[model samples]
Target: MIERVKKYIRENHMLKAGDMVAAGVSGGADSIAMLHILKCIQHDMGFELEAVHIHHGIRGEEADRDESMVRKICEEWEIPFEVYHYPVPELAKEWKLGEEETGRIVRKQAFFRERERMGFPEQKTEDQPQFLVALAHNRNDLAETMLHHLARGTGLRGLAGIRPCGDGIIRPVLCLERREIVNYLKEKGISYITDSTNLSDEYTRNRIRHHVLPAMEKEINPRAVEHMAETARMLAAADHYLLEKGSRLLSGCERKDGYLFEGEFFREDQIIQEYAVLEAFGKLAGKRKDFTALHVEQVLSVSEKGIGRYIRLPQNLYAVRQYEGVHLGKTVPRKAPESTESLVKREKYPAEDFWEIPVPGSLECPFGIFEAKIFSYKKQKIEEKKCTKWFDYDKIKNSPCVRTRRQGDFLVVNREGGRKKLNRIFIDEKIPASLRDKIPVVAAGSEILWIPGGRMNEQYKITSTTGRVLELHYQGGVLA
Candidate 1:
């Protein structure tokens, strides 16, 4: 078991030379065995080890006994020990969160505080291995998480279950089963406290452990826990691949206030699409504690409509579709960067303000005055790309107003008509941010019909089948 765990740690690259790892000891068989295993390998691995114990203030004297036992174990191992006492029940009420969530938060904060107190980590950045908080999630814990996620209706990420290392926490003992940990401790003559609450089926986790797991073992596969753990690892690898691919796709569609998701975002497989939306929410949300697969579905559903369509999410964040892209941002403007002046140029047309369009009529904006005329398809001789553009008039349902680009404006980039955020296009084309107001945009809803010299949205362009053609000619100022 020890050799298998050591192999798992090495395979995951959980530690490196000169690293400092903190083992979170709950005075239970799982954590105690993990601490011992880590201690056994630390010298050869050339890393330092310390132990941290959290007194959650729920089990009364049992909690104190747990802390004392961990302190004693740390002393015997000649390693530093840190203990934190957090009133998790009161804090849970105060924070309006469940006790389980509050306890997890408090424990994480204590671990971070301990890590900081231990002095500066030698390395920082993606390439270097992180100094981590070692957690005691065994194979059984992983199987329980998988079952929990499945019960809740989850995606690939949920199926992936508990990660070995993420956000500075490492579960080095996850490769071992709880029974294996208890047996290893017994073999080593080490005693651990068994939390009495664990014996009761009061909690959902306990019910799973005491009832569900035993039934599965007796009636189904005896190695069900190991099988589930193995499945989780495979799913985790697949999730990693999709995340990397989605990240690249996300970079193209993201904007300043939120992501301008469209085109590749929706064109990719559903797995990538779901991952992208989830990632976008994580980026925009202050705390990503409550988003779910349902939220992702809602976002995607609303994102396919015309401009101004939106779905409000938890924490006041929303995903809105405008023109060619979907934006994920707060429904209310952010407080800090509110001074950043936000998206869409606030420049008022010096010569004119925008008005709704009528077919074959003239409209005026600050940049220029444009004349629109519709003629029969046979009479069409399209000319002058600089000052004029032709569109299939019959295809345009609503009157596409000729004006400056608005807050949610987007442009279709290619002949295939994949959408790109207007701002994204400006940045991609190296159009000076200052030149945006000077650009004349003809748009209908979120869709941009023409950006004058830049592009005539491919979806609206005159095709050979065009029976009636609409010609737009700008007559005044810079665009002319």
Candidate 2:
């Protein structure tokens, strides 16, 4: 068992010398064996070892006893130990999350706290890398995960199962079966606490392990975990290829509106395009809920027409049809005018509109237009929330074109009262660099007049006796 773990670690380049490793001990045979083998390996591998025990506060006195046992073991081994004390039920309620997610969050918080307390922010020494959190997931757990995802009708990504290494976490004992861990614990004659809740068939995982796996072992092959693990590896490789191809295909289809797929793509092959769309859309919405085949079929059914339409999905996401395209995304509500039925015909514009010159007026950029305009106030009363603005036309240039920010743009901000580059303005506003190019800036020659959601140039302002009233309003393009 130890040899298998060692081989897996070596293959993954998981652990290295002088690394501060922490083990998540849940008072189980798998975790105990993990700690034992890790301690043995640390000496030869040249890494530091520590243990973390979390008291879920659900098991009453038994939980306290578990913590005490863990502390004693760590003290005997001369290793640093930490314990997280949290109210599980309260956390579950406040976050509107399940027991598993709450437990994970608090335990991670405690681990990082202990790590920082142990002089973190210290870079790796010449001998090794920094630190890593080690888990004790065995082969049976991996198999169970695959089965669970399959039961839930998950996508190909879920079939890849539990990863051995991801970011700061590593599972060195993932290659070993649960029985080997129990045997290892017996060989060492080490006594560890076990949660009584694990015996009860209340949890889904426990039920699967006790009832489902045992029945499978009786009727089917006993080496199910091994076979499943092998299948997972093959599926993971195939999943990688499909993901790459899907992503490449999606690159052309991806748009701000949403991703568009040709309906014929799903009919062609095993790599289902409908599943790909749901997966992609769910990711965009920051979720991975098991969107079923039924959901994909519904999305496909609506997109057969040429005109665009919106279809609400399981999550707070939408599937919309476009001109010769269909997309799934978050739908932004269209703003309608007072007594207006649709978005397009809501805003009333005059065919013949002209205004006399007046003082400077503040104008907000319309939905599609990025630049704010300054013109003479023509209308008597205008709502602050309205996209249109009336500015004093006489205070500024006679004719200025509304456009996006050009390179080498400069602005004299009112707040700072100094000339600064548009790039600097974007940085000061903390606008993500990727979005800076898309931001609209009103410009006259080399001077930037306005940056929406940011500072407006102080140079242009309403003055007294401005005759020409300039009505600055957004025209053409998509409404924001």
Candidate 3:
């Protein structure tokens, strides 16, 4: 078991000399063996070590015993130990979250809290190196996880199973099985605590471990654990390869606002590209992706349309198809005040009476302004003459302020005295109800001036009699 762990550390490049390490000791055989192995190697590894235990307060006395056992083991090894108590059931109820998810959150929170509280650890003097947060998810655990993900219809990421090292967590004993860990403890004459809740059939994972695995061993194959573990190991390697390749491809096609990819990318033989986009999009959303292949199909359907279309994403973000490209951006603008009570706080204004927001650039004012320079011919091609309003360079006033629409705001929408309310125009345009609060309408008193990158009042529109044209295109929101 020790040699296998050493090999895993070396193979995965998990740790080096002179590092601070924390172990999540659950008092189970796997964690105990991991803690013991680290302790045994401490002299040669040259690293500091600490232990953290999270008491989920589920099994009452058994939970307490787990914490006590971890503290005692750490004390015997002369390593630092921290314990956290969480009311998992209460939290599960309050958050409307499953108990499993609640426990995971609480455990991770405890780990981070202890990490911060302990401060930076001193460099190892003679040990190999302390493996940071060494978790004891063994081969058997990996088999179970793979089965779980398989049962749940997971994709490549889920099939990859627990990573050896990710974001400061290390699973050092993943190369060994549970029985191997127990055997190593017995050989070393080491004792560990056991949680009785694990014997119950209430939890799905518990049932898998206690009943399903034993049944599989008897009915299917005596070496079911080994076979399943081996399959998982192979799948994890292949999944990692695909994920890395996909990430590289996705990065090349990414943009600041969102991502753009050819429809063929999704249609290609390589499904990894789509997964990579999903991974990037998930990160941009600041949340885990809940999207399935069906959702991807929906996105692909819109992308194939070859016209501008918007699909609402899970977290209020939107995926838009524009001119043979797909864009992912926040669908909803950040909510801000619509009232004019804070108008007097304004400072800088656009030069002269007309604000020339400089070509090939953006101008930041009280509201958003984003602009791009396009050739006259190209501009004519993309711009909808009806939706777009161009201003004559001479008629434009340099002094302009960007603000929300107010009462009595009127725009001469047409040459025939067809005056209309700015709010009414927005409503008629079918702008989303929630977005009305965010669109910044350029105004010069009660007269609606330019809607900036959007529709301008007919009074402000440049006609055939008008001279030179400088186009200011306005979208649904403030450009800035």
Candidate 4:
């Protein structure tokens, strides 16, 4: 098992010399086995290890015991350890999110915190971050994930299953089966804590893990899990290639009023065209989620005419096929000039349109997902792409918020910190007046930091002396 895992790590280049890997140890068998394996190999591989535990607070005393168990194990191995103590239920309720999402959020927060603990500012010259996170997802986890996505109506990315490595995280033990992990623990005579919740079928994942995969294994092929994972791996490779081709296909589209894809776009295969439009839509929105096959088919139906009227899309985005090809833009609600109420409604942001950005967290806006994380910075080269950007953390003085432009909203211009009205920005940039109200703007206090599809304020940009950098990565936005 160890040899196979080592080979997998080698093949994947999951670790590099001088990597300070923070292993998320949940005190569960999978995590423990992962930590043990990494610990055994880390020294020889010339990488440092740290163990991090997050007490989810839902399991009461058992949760505390889990933390203690993980701590003792780390201590025995002389590993540096830290515990992220968070109230999951309270956070979930306050954020208006489910327990599952809240847990994922907190875990991500814990990982970033550990990354900050590791010394030095990451070099821009480096393709990967200096510190990396290793997860314990096994073959069963991957199989369960595939089933979960399949049941929910997923796209190609979802069907690709759990990613082994990306965004500064790697799943070293993902190549190992659950049984292999258990056997490794037994062979080494290592005792580990198990979460009581895993035995319960209350959660969707729990039910799937306990019933769905096992049934597939028994009723169908005995090697279903292995075969499914292998299939996912192959699909992931194909998806990557398709996305690259789709990007090239979508290059001709203009984002101002809406995407204007030339007739050349429709020349691709129908399957390729579906993915191509999906990518284009995602780029315009700054992130597209819950986008299903139905959405794709709806857009396709209109384009089949080679000329169609405006087709309203979900999330206020709209599409139209014309002599100029296809145009994807935000749907602007027309109002009567005679109606006073209509004029008033157009002047302000809707109550539901704005959401607060959590400190060191993520928020969902109409544009897409903006994940904010802070890290101490000593500037190396910062490659600013269209979708992702970074800012000087200390410059943001208030809780960040995401919403459509409001009256008097402005972005800072010039080194003097002079202000420019957002409306003026729109006009200056030749942005269509119709699309201004629909564009997503991220404001830190009174200052507008980023207009996702538009311009970012230069005054708040990260500098060499900046102590901390705020990474604002937007998913579903224009990508470079």
Candidate 5:
């Protein structure tokens, strides 16, 4: 088993000489076996080894015992060790996430923190050795994950299950089965602590492990886990191939706002198109948490719709069909305001919902800091700039607030007090329909005082009768 793991690590290019490797040891058979194997091969492999243990804080005394056992093992072997404790249940509530997801997040945080403490560089270079975290996922774990994803309706990436290595982490014992890990530990007379939760079906993975996998092994095939692991590897290879080809095709589709998939993009095979859309969405979202195959299909469906048609997606993103191609971007603040009576009835606004501009002070908004100051009128030229504007302090009937456009939003179009709806101005300016919602406006009641990149209300223009000039400057918001 040790030799086989060594060969797998080498083949995967998981480590090199002088590399620092941290193995996650949970005091379970799988983790214990992996730690021992890596310890045995560290000198030959020319890498440094340490153990990291994470306590989920749900198992109480059992969890304490597990931590103690792992610490003792590392001490006896003279291996550097680190342990992190997290209240997963409490954190799950605080983060609005599941216990399982919370645990995974904290575990990753612990591993990355350990790497930083060990003085590993943030990025890897050709001349430098790597800093890797080793996980103890076995063939059975891979099979279980595949089954879980299948039950949840997964895509090719989900069907591929776990990889040998990714994102600065490696699974050195992924080739081994659960039974093999236990047999090896028993042969070596090593003891391990088991969590009581594993015996219950409270969790989906636990149910699969306790019932579904065992039934499949007994009735369907004795080597079901092994065969599933093999199948996952093949699927991973195919997924990788599609990802590379799709990425190459998407390379030229990059746009200032987002990727623009031209008509030529539709000529590719449908599978390749799906992969390319997946890649683009992932890049825009920064993470693919709730983005599933259904969302991918929605994005693809936009191609068949009219030019103005768009579909909302997770992470406040949208895919809109355009004359050139499909445009993907974030949803800007476009909610129109209610009637003026509704605005007057509201007593307060949450800081996140809207910002009340401070006279002679600065306030931060979606676009950036909006600084305002009131001074006696001076006989000087009002220099014009895209982000800066001036208004008559006394002519403003109400305190100005910075926010997105509202339903009755309108700007004074002439000295005669003629008004133009905000939407009409957007159209007259020929602003991209997708960008209309993102523009920030300063308003008093339902009347817009200033449009940062465009115009200020003509009613607020400074004149000989203007007693004070209210200067407003906007700093730092992306218009393009």
Candidate 6:
């Protein structure tokens, strides 16, 4: 057992010379066997070892006995030991979380606190001594986890089950079967305490262990647990490879606010697209708890819908379908205007809605500053810049206002005064729906003269008979 565990540790690079390993020993058969195995191999592996026991503040005398047994074993073996007590039941209620989840959280907190107290660096580096927390998950546990995830509906990552090593934690005895661990402990004459909770069917995992797995082993394959563990290892490898590919696909799709997934993203395999979207969601949310395959599907579904459509998500995030791609971010765009009359009749508009541009002065608005100036038309070379436009100044019927689109907003599409609604123009231009409300348009009432970075109304174009030129320059925002 020691040789097999050593091989597994080496394969996973769980330790190196001068490293410190803190093992969680709960006086159960699996953890006790793991502590013994790690103790036997620590000298040969050139690493230091210590034992940690968590008292979950439940089960009364039984819990105390478990902690006492673990401490006695550590003392006899000359291994350093530490114990942490947490009121898991009380904390569960206070935190508004399940007891199981609260227990897991406290266990992790205790392990990290021990690491910090030992003067170990939080982050591992090649040149410095590394610190790791060792767990005692066996093959049977891995199989149980896989079945649990499968029953609850999960993707590849969930199906991969318990990992041998991740995020500074190591599971050295993961390759060992439950029977092998019990037999080894018996041969060594080492006493261990079993939690009474394991005997009850109250927990879902206990029910699986007591009934589901035994039925599978009897009616189906005798080595069902071993087979499931093997399958989980394979799935873990595939998941790692796909996540790397997804990360590569997400590159260059970053926007100022969040990530953008365009048509090229959809061209990839559906699985790859899902992984990329999942990664983007995780990045923006800062965590993946409660994020499921269903959420990923919802975000992807927006791609098939019209531009400006969005799905509200957990963590106050949103995934908006843009003209070019799907944008994932925390910013929620303002609601779109239903009609021009509704907008004109509103008693008030946001400060971003309107700013009058003086004939030869500058005005600041939500999108940016607009500078207007009149100059003599001497057949000067018209610069073809998106931020700068030349219009017939004498043709202006009213002072132009820099604002967002309103109902009945139209642009002159032809020399013969043919008009195009702003909504129609946006549809023809493929502008994202969310952006239509934000794009600053130079308008004279409902007649839009110029959509900076896009087209200008034909009526405002410079002509040979024009005597004065109105040059409007935009200085900021998306268009700029």
Strongest candidate by TM-score: 6
The regions of model 6 sitting more than 4 angstroms off are 336-480
TM-score of 2: 0.62
| Alpha-carbon RMSD to native, per candidate | 21.1, 20.5, 19.9, 14.7, 17.0, 22.2
Judging by lDDT, tell me the better candidate of 1 and 6: 6
**TM-scores across all candidates?**
0.66, 0.62, 0.64, 0.67, 0.69, 0.69
Query: Could you tell me the TM-score of candidate 1?
Result: 0.66
Where model 3 places Cα greater than 4 Å from the true spot, the runs are 120-131, 263-270, 332-480
Candidate 3 positional error at 422, Å = 40
Q: Tell me which of candidates 4 and 5 scores higher on TM-score.
A: 5
* Clash tally for model 4: 5
lDDT of 3 by residue, 329-400 (tens): 664424322333111112333223333355433344434332423222212212354324455444556433
- Model 1 clash pairs are 323-446
- lDDT for model 3, on a 0 to 1 scale? 0.65
Q: Model 6, residue 316: what's the lDDT? A: 68
- Candidate 6, 307: how far from true, in Å? 2.1
> Model 1, 1-480: lDDT tens per residue?
778888998999887877778899999999999999888888888888889899999878888888889999889988888899999877876775456678989998898788678765645875554567899998898888888667645677889889998777789998888888888988999999898978976565777889898899889999999899889988999989988887777788867777877776788888788877778777777555566665676677766565775555556676666787777786542332121222122345532446565555555443445667656664333554665777888877777776655677887778886888888887877766666665667787778887765577888777788887777766332110
Error at 435, model 6, angstroms? 26
Residue pairs with backbone overlap in model 6: 340-407
Cα lDDT of model 2 by residue, 25-103, tens digit: 8877888889988987778788888998888887788888888888888888787788889998677766754566688
**Which one wins by lDDT: 5 or 6?**
6
Clash tally, candidates in order: 1, 23, 23, 5, 4, 1
lDDT of 4 by residue, 1-480 (tens): 877778888888887877778999999999999999898898788888999999888889899899999999999999999999988888876775456678999999888777777663544335543688889999999989888777654767889999889868889998888888899899999998878878987566888989988898899988998998899899899888888887777776656676776667777777677777788678768777745555566566556544544445546676666776666777542421221121111234562467787656655443456677665564344535665677888877887788877777888788788889988887887766655675667886657888764578888787777887777766442100
Score candidate 4 by TM-score against the native: 0.67
